[model samples]
Target: MLKFVKNHMESIEGVATYPMISLLIFFVFFALLFWWVFTASKAYIKEVSELPLENDNNQPKEDLL
Candidate 1:
C-alpha cells in the first residue's frame, strides 16, 4: 500500500506547494471566524451587563389616581 501511494504521488504533476497553501488558507479562515465570534460575544456581554443599570435607574413607580 505504501509503495503504491508513493508511486502515485511521484506520478502527480505540480503539487509541491499544496501543503503550505492549504495551511495558510485554513489559518485565515479560522482567524476570521475567531474574530467574528469574539466581537459578537463581547457585544452581547456588554448589552446584558448594562441591563441591570438601566432597570435600576428606571424602576417603575406606582401611579396614584
Candidate 2:
C-alpha cells in the first residue's frame, strides 16, 4: 500500500509544492489562533468559561400529567 501510494504521488506534477503550501497554511493558522488566545480579553474569557454554569431560565417547564 505504501509503495502504491508513493508511485502514484510521483506521477502527479507539482506534488512537491502541495505539501509545502499545506504545511505553511497549517503553521499560519495555528500561529494566529495562539496569538488570539493570548491577546483575548480576560473578562470575555471568563464569561465564556462560565456560560455552561449560568442558568438563564430559558428552558420550558415540562408538565407532568
Model 1 TM-score is: 0.51
Write the residue-wise lDDT of candidate 2 on 1-65 in tens digits.
99999999999999999989999999999999999999999999987886775456733234221
Top candidate, metric lDDT: 2
Candidate 1 lDDT over 1-65, as tens digits, reads 99999899878887667888999999999999998877787778787776755545454333221
* Model 1 residue 56 lDDT score: 50
Candidate 2 local distance difference test against the native: 0.85
User: lDDT for each of the candidates?
Assistant: 0.76, 0.85
Give all TM-scores, in the order shown.
Answer: 0.51, 0.76
